[model samples]
Target chain A: MIGNAGDMNVVVCVKQIPDPANPGSLDANNNLDRSSKLIIDDSDMYGVEMALQLVHAAGSGEVSLVSMAPNGETAGLRTALAMGAEKAVLVSDDTLKGSDALGTAKVLAAAIKRIEGADLILAATESSDGYTGTTPVQVAEILGLPSVTFAKHIEVDGSTVKVQRQTEAGYDEVTCPLPALVTVTAGVVEPRYPSFKGIMAAKGKPLDQVTVADLGIDAAQVGGDGAGQKITNVTAAEARKAGEVVVDEGDAFQKIVAFLDQLKVI
Target chain B: MAKVWVLAESAGGKVSSLSLELLTKARELGDTVEAVAWGADTASIAGDLGAHGASTVHDLGDLGTSLPGVSVAAAIAAAIEAGTGPDILLVGQSYDGRDVAGRLSAKLDKPVLTNVVGLAAGEPPVASHAIFGGATIVEATFTGSAPFIYAVRPKSFAAEPSGGSATVAPLSVPETGATNAATVVDRHVEERSGPQLDEAAVVVSGGRGLGEAANYAMIEELAKLLKGAPGASRAIVDAGWVPYAYQVGQTGKTVKPTLYIAAGISGATQHMVGMKGSKNIIAINKDQEAPILQIADLGIVGDVHKVLPQLIEALKARS
Candidate 1:
C-alpha cells in the first residue's frame, strides 16, 4: 500500500518560530520567550508548499503536519493547514521545553511512526530561529529511513523520490525510494498565501494534539535535563566599530579604488 | 592526548577546502588527528590530508555513486562500535557533511553540535555557535560521552600545509541497505561565467537600491571588470531581481571574500551576517545610516547609479 504510485502520504515538519523581524528576548530559562506571538517560519513554508505540490501532482494523497511547540501552540500549524495541509499532529508538553535537536527529532520520529503509513517526510533545511539544520536527518535516522538534505527540487515516481540537492559548486541529482525523508531549502518553491477561503476552511481541519506520554517518550529523555549539549555561556558578539565614512564627492569612486588598491585585491 | 576524527570531503580525488580547514584545527585540539574519506581510491589525496596535519587516513572504498550519507554514517558507526572511533568527530557544515552528522547522531544516540564557528580546547572541548543573525555567540559543551560530532561551518578556520605525511588505511565498506537507497542519477551544474561566490577573492553585490532589474547589469559589469564574482542581497533576490544562487545573506550563502563591495545595498542584519567576515568592505549606498556602512572599511555615501558607472569607466580607462 505504501508503494502505490498515486497514494503518497507526506508529513511536513513545521515550527512556530518567533518573528525574526522582531527582536526577541530570552526568558529566565534561557529559551526564546514563547509568550510572544509566533508565526509559521518562512523556511518551513517552503516544505509545506513543496509537500502540497507533490501531493497534488500525485492526484491522490494527503499532506499532514508534525510540529512540537510549547504551550500547545496551534497558531503556526493553523497557517500550514490553511495552506492546504489536510491534518496536523502537534506534540506539545510543558516538559518538552528546551528539548535540543536530538530530543525534538526523537519526538517527531515517534509521532511520524504512529501515522499509520507515511510515504515521505518533508522538512525545511533549518529553522530561522535555531538554525541547527540537523533535525530532519536525525528524525530519518531514528526512523531508519533514507534521507536527503538541501533539496532544491523533488520528483516522486513509482516507489522512488528524486531530488536536486544543492551544493557549494552547483547541485547533485539524488534519488531515494519511498518512505524516505527530504529537507527542502528555502526559495525552492514559492509558497502561496492563505486565501480567505482556505483560511476559513482551515478552521475545521483536524489538529490532533498529543503529549510525550502518548508518544511513549520518556519525560526524562527530553527537555533540558536530557539534552546532551548545554550552553555554558552566552555573550554578545563584538560589534563592528564605525569605519571611515566619506560623503560622495566626485572623487568618491577614486577613493574606493585607492582603498581596493591598498588591499591589493584588484 | 585525545584522538580527533575529521571527515575529509573529497570530490574527484580533490580534498574539499572545508575538510582541510577542519583537519588543521583538529590538530590543535587532539594529540592525534585522523581523516576519513569515502571513495574507491583515496590514496591520491592522502598526502593532501597529511599536509593538513592528519596522521592517518581511513579510506572507505567504493561506496557507489550515491550521496554517501547513509553508507558513510553506517561505516563510521560500526567503527565506533568496534572501539576504533576518535574521541571527537568533526564534520564540515556542507550539505553532505550535515547529512552524515545527523544520521550518525541518531544512530549513535549522541547529539551533534552544528553551526559551530569556533572551538576551544578543554576537557570536553567547547564549541562556539553564532546565533541571532550573528549577533550573539553561545559556547556549548558535550556532557554525555566521547565521539561527539560537530558540524563546523566553512571558513571558520584557516587551512595550512604542515609538510607531513600520513599512513593511508582501508576501511571496509558496508553493504548498501534500505537507508542507502538514495542515488544520484543526474546533475546539472549552474553555468557560472565567473569565479564561485564562496571562493572568489573579490565580490561585488547589489541590493534593492538598484531601482530596476536592469540596473543590475551595471553591477555585473563592475564585478566582471574587477575580476570578481557577482552577489545579491536578500531584498533583490526576493524581489525577483536575481536567482537564489546569487543571494548573499544569513539565509543565503556565507562569504568571506578578501574584498566585498556592496552597491546600493542598505545593509540589514540578515545580509550583514553572510558577508561580515569579509576582510575588507566597501559600501556604496545613498543612505549613510545603512547598517552595512558601520562595518565597511570604506563607506561611500553616494548613489550606486552615479558611483558604479564612473568606477567602471575609471577601471576600464586604467586597463
Candidate 2:
C-alpha cells in the first residue's frame, strides 16, 4: 500500500540490530541471541534521514520502512516510525531466522514488489552487527534495478537521482534513473532527533506485518536450512597481552619512540 | 587446480595494491589465476599483475569515467555467460569493488561472502570473517555452484611480487544497455596533505577526549610530526569534529597500519575491529583501565592534552 501522489515514493530498509555496546551471547545454534533488547543500527539512521529529506524536498511524498526481524519485534521499527516514516512493512517469521544475506535480500525485494508503486529503495551500506554489506545490492539485483553503494550525498532531479559515491581515493558522481536502490554510509547527513509530537504521532502509524507464507516464499529458501554459506566453526581471537605502560613523567615520549623503534614502525 | 579471478582496480594505469594482494593469495589457492580490469588500459598493469601470479590479464577497455560498478559487473557477467567465469572471484572491500561484486552476484544469482579476512584452500574455498568487533573469527564455506564471489578487506593479505610475466588478452563482452544510463557529472577528491588513513604506515587517532573540536588540530599536528596520517574515533566524527573520511571504525574505514596510536579513545568494539589488525597499538588516555588499553601494545596512563603537546614537540625536535 503506497500513499501520497508525491514526486517520489521511497522505501527505506531499517535493521534492529543487537546493541554493539553490550556483549552479545550466542544461542544453541551458535547464532547471535536475538532475545536481547534490540535497537536501531546507527548506520541505518542515515538512510531514514535521507529518505525523509528527499520526501520533504519533493514537496509531496511519503517514506515507508521495511524491516525483517525475529518474532515480529517492532521496537526498532517503532523508532524509525518516530522519525516521520508514514508506515512500515515488517516481515517476521520463524522460517526466516538465520537467513543469509541473499535470502534476506530476496524477502526484501518481494516486499518492495508488493508495495505497488515504490520508485526508490534506500538502505545502509551494512548493518552494524551483521556487516555483510551485500544485501542492498542483492536486493537490487533480485528486483532487476540498478544499485549504488556508499553514497555520501544524494540529489533528485526530475526522473533521475544523482549520488556522490565514496571511493578509496575520492568520490565518483553517478546518476541513475528512478526505481533504483541506494545504500548510504553513516554520517552522510545529520539525522534529526524525534520530537515529542513526532514520537507521539508514531503510535498511530500503520505497521503492516507479513509472514513467509504471506509472501509465498519457500521455507527451504531461507533460514539456516537454505543458507548458501554455513559458518562451520567459530573461535575466539587470541587475547592481547597486557603490555608495558609508562606514566607520562615528562620523558614518556622518549619511551614511546624507543618502543616504536623496537617494533621498527617509526 | 581451481581457477581464480581477481577484479583488479586501477588508476592512472597502475593496479591497486589490494588487487595485487588478492592475486598473491589467489596464486596459492588455484592452478590458474587471472585478472580483470576496466576503464583504463590494462597493458600498463599486465606485467604488474603477472608478478603477483596472474597468468592472464583481461581488459574491458575504457568505459568512460563514470562509476565502474555497472559496466565492469556487466562485462564480467557476460564473460560468465560465455563460459569464461572462474571458480572464485575476489574483489577488494573498497566501494566500487563491492558495487561490482554485488551487481555480479545479482546477475549470476550467487551469494557473495563479504568482509572476508582469511581464506582456506578447499574444493569450493572457505572464507573467514571477524565478527562481533574482531572478538571471534568465523569460517564459512559456499555450498552452491562455481564462481563463489568474495569482497575481501584490505591489508588482510600481504602482496608479494613473484617476478613473472603474464599474457595479456582483450575480452569482448556484449553491451549491457543499462551500463551507460548512470553517468558521471562531477568528481571531487578531498584535499589531504599527508598519507591516506588506510595507507598510512602510522595512524594517530583522536577521540572525544580531545575535549572540543578545536583540539583536533593537536592530533593532526602530532601526526604530521610523526610523518603519519590523522584519524578519528567514531565519537569525534559523529560529533562533527572531523569528516567521515577520517573515521576509523567498523562503520567507517578499516585500517591496518604498521602503527596505530589511539589518543583519548575509549576503545569501543566498533572502533577496535577496524584497527585491531594493526602491527602495533599504542593508547594514550587518562583512564588507565579504558578498553583500548587492554589491546594496546604500549599504554600510556596520562592526559592526552598534556601528553600530546609534549610528544609533538619531542617529535619535532627529533625530526
Best by lDDT: 1
**Given candidate 1, what's the lDDT at residue A221?**
80
A226-254 per-residue lDDT for model 2 (tens digits): 77777888999877776888888877777
Give residue B55's lDDT in candidate 1 (0 to 100). Answer: 85
Residue A216 of model 1, lDDT score: 96
TM-score of chain B of each: 0.91, 0.93
Best by TM-score: 2
Candidate 2 TM-score to native: 0.95
Expressed as tens digits, the lDDT of each residue in B1-319 for candidate 2 is 7889999999878888889999999988888999988755788888899999888988888877556777778888888887887888999988788878877887787888889999888978889988777888888888888888988988789999988888888876567665346677777787889998888989999999999999999989978876899999988887788887898987677888888999999898779988998888999988877889889899998888888888777767767
> Chain B of candidate 2 versus the native chain B: what TM-score?
0.93
Q: Supply candidate 1's per-residue lDDT for B202.
A: 92
lDDT of 2 at A198: 86
Residue pairs in collision within model 2: none
